[model samples]
Target: MPGISARGLSHEGRRQLAVNLTRVLALHRSILDAYIIEFFTDNLWDTLPCSWQEALDGLNPPQLATMLLGMPGEGEVVRYRSVWPLTLLALKSTACALAFTRTPGFQTASEFLENPSQSSRLTAPFRKHVRPKKQHEIRRLGELVKKLSDFTGCTQVVDVGSGQGHLSRFMALGLGLMVKSIEGDQRLVERAQRLDQELLQALEKEEKRNPQVVQTSPRHSPHHVVRWVDPTALCEELLLPLENPCQGRARLLLTGLHACGDLSVALLRHFSCCPEVVALASVGCCYMKLSDPGGYPLSQWVAGLPGYELPYRLREGACHALEEYAERLQKAGPGLRTHCYRAALETVIRRARPELRRPGVQGIPRVHELKIEEYVQRGLQRVGLDPQLPLNLAALRAHQAQENRVVAFFSLALLLAPLVETLILLDRLLYLQEQGFHAELLPIFSPELSPRNLVLVATKMPLGQALSILETEDS
Candidate 1:
């Protein structure tokens, strides 16, 4: 079957899909828990489908022990473990969602975009320049910024929440676009400025020493410079160049990489309201912090729909895994247990220091090597509880025996995570469409390298130009 084609799909159609997706996610909403509460909680098992319960019920500890930790005698369970009814249920709901929401027809921006620059080696100089993750984002998003520049004939960019300004520097120096970076943190702004100066100086020294440059006309002139600002707020006053026209910069391509929570929404709002802001290529993270304008149903249609109240933690579930569903099952199982460990400690705390009733502990030392009693006691001490608090060793051992069920519980939550995230992204796309902008979501980077990899790329082009770009997809 053909993949989803966002241009070919209508905004109402996307809305309808969002409505359908909410049902699928809500079906198991009761099973989902905040990661902070996932471990040491027991109700997740109740939310499991009856079939899953039956399958699990059929297995005794001796029978189910192999798959949990793969001990020697328990290997037999692995042999007969072909059927995964719970996973099938999750896949079934996902398939239903895939039918409604179109895939935007492309993964990386490079697929639909023309070569970002005439020169083939745009990222070579930046090879050793930044951290591995930052380097990946710098190249990928930099290419998109360059593509937007070439598309709109606007070489002006505003990088919002420009931490340490790694992306901002690339947009200005590598692409030679006029950049205005706004960061809330003053220290990062200073650091970004210092690095920008150092790099520019180093390039100048190299050019003078060689005298005879390899490339004619100097592909990189170092003439371009980045303007940095420390914004006191997230309001439009800081976005002057893009929000309202200023000298020499009429239309601006507003780009932000990993603008957490409300920052991405603010950019989208700016894109819709401000005409001079011609384009947006933004990636958002930290969903937990997004201030719900009204509630879980952020879009008008989703807001009006029945049974559409989204919890913040469930909204957070959407970002569970960016690459593949299988990743959740294979590698994430151990990490999921850390939450369990914390919750288990919380349970112990409640029992011994019932009056104190300290609900949760912020930071605890690692608990892997320590036995359950030692682990619980150490965790108690870290949280300022009585370190010498007593725990029932045998009973605690029995509680630990239920570790497999906890994994099952988390797996169920993980299944719903992507669907929830998609619903959120789709709602944002629909919101943009309502505001009269052409928008689409794209997995613009390698998920393995960066989990929060999908970017919401949109443009405010005229109908003719927009159609031309969509036609290129078929070509």
Candidate 2:
């Protein structure tokens, strides 16, 4: 990927990043698929060089993610000895791809340092009204909308896939902009409307108690409208009716905090084509759900590459959480052990009852803090198998002795997570830039709090026009 998508970069610089992902994923294909082999099936004893197993046997869970990838040199691996030189090849290659994709995927760190505080943007009444995580997202995203709206002279905000209308309520009630909260689920749309009514009532009651109340806005309009509509099927005609009736005309700022899968892409497609859509700030999630008619490659440039097909497994890998995984590993007791059981049980099912393996173990409720013997017993019951059916615990234990291999295999796959997300986002950013929009990615919220922290912020104006507003507002 391009080092960084500086505003100064040419269109070709941004376009080249489109395929940077395809090439990296293809290069690592064999090494990645190697992870699919069951731990008990092959010792992979031959795959690792001499004494590699001895080193692996010694390291703790928290040390694994960084053990191999962070340290490729002898001095580095000596600290966490399990990583064989040969295995380090794939992990090291993935790290390079990740670095390239990540650097260009967003604005520099200083931009985040420059973001206005949540306290300055949100009033005390509004701050207390929302959850902390939600509060952070609202202020961060809200600031983006403010920039976009001011740049395009837009008076309306449309929150797509606005689940439960948290952001919509914040925009309409707190920011004093007209908002149309579009949710795919009708039940959620109704519930969001009811919640808005309750919040308005509460705010009014508080105003009576504290006459000196520093409201988010004295001009606040309680016009938080809810609509049940699939964004893919929505058009400008539908949007006209949803607009704040008080305004004679309005430019719409289309946004989604974490629009799932193809829904976010669809929003971008609509926003790009629709003349009414002046700007957007969409943060996407649930990449595995992204549908691929031609292939998983969404951008035209990436799709044009021959024999390139992104699988669901690759998208699944993209969702891996490095920070969260490390934190889990550091926790006390058998907390992190839960990761290994499900994969091991899949092997058991293949041997014991292959016919029952069709739908898979997704619905199996977690067997919290169970020993291997008890875990299998409870796990069997979860899949509707007879709990009394005895398994050879001794044999399973022998296989469990190689638990380090399982952790190593997963950690290798986890390395590609951020790269996959970057490639996907880069495609979107490049597409928007190609459309003559000043497009860029911005990180919102602490990554530790929210794994998918990046938001694609863009506008249909000259480069300096939109970003200047962000700088001016900051000053």
Best by lDDT: 2
- Go through the candidates in order and give each one's C-alpha lDDT: 0.61, 0.63
TM-score of each: 0.78, 0.82
lDDT of 2 by residue, 1-475 (tens): 1224334446676565555656777876644444333444444444544555555554666566446435232233435443456645555565654432222232323433534333444555565546656766776677668767777887678888887777887777866777777776778877777777777777788788888874654544334444544545655542563545465655778888888888788778777887778788888888888876622565666668654566777776776666576555445246555545655665666677876552344444555556776776667777777778778888778656656566666665666666677777877776776677777776555554567767787778764655645533332
Model 1: residues with Cα > 4 Å off, grouped in runs: 1-8, 33-41, 56-129, 205-237, 242-249, 294-298, 322-336, 353-366, 462-475
In angstroms, give how far residue 440 of model 1 lies from its true place.
Answer: 0.9
lDDT of candidate 1 at residue 142, scale 0 to 100 = 79
- Minimal lDDT window, size 10, model 1: 223-232
Task: Tell me the number of clashing residue pairs for each predicted model.
Answer: 3, 1
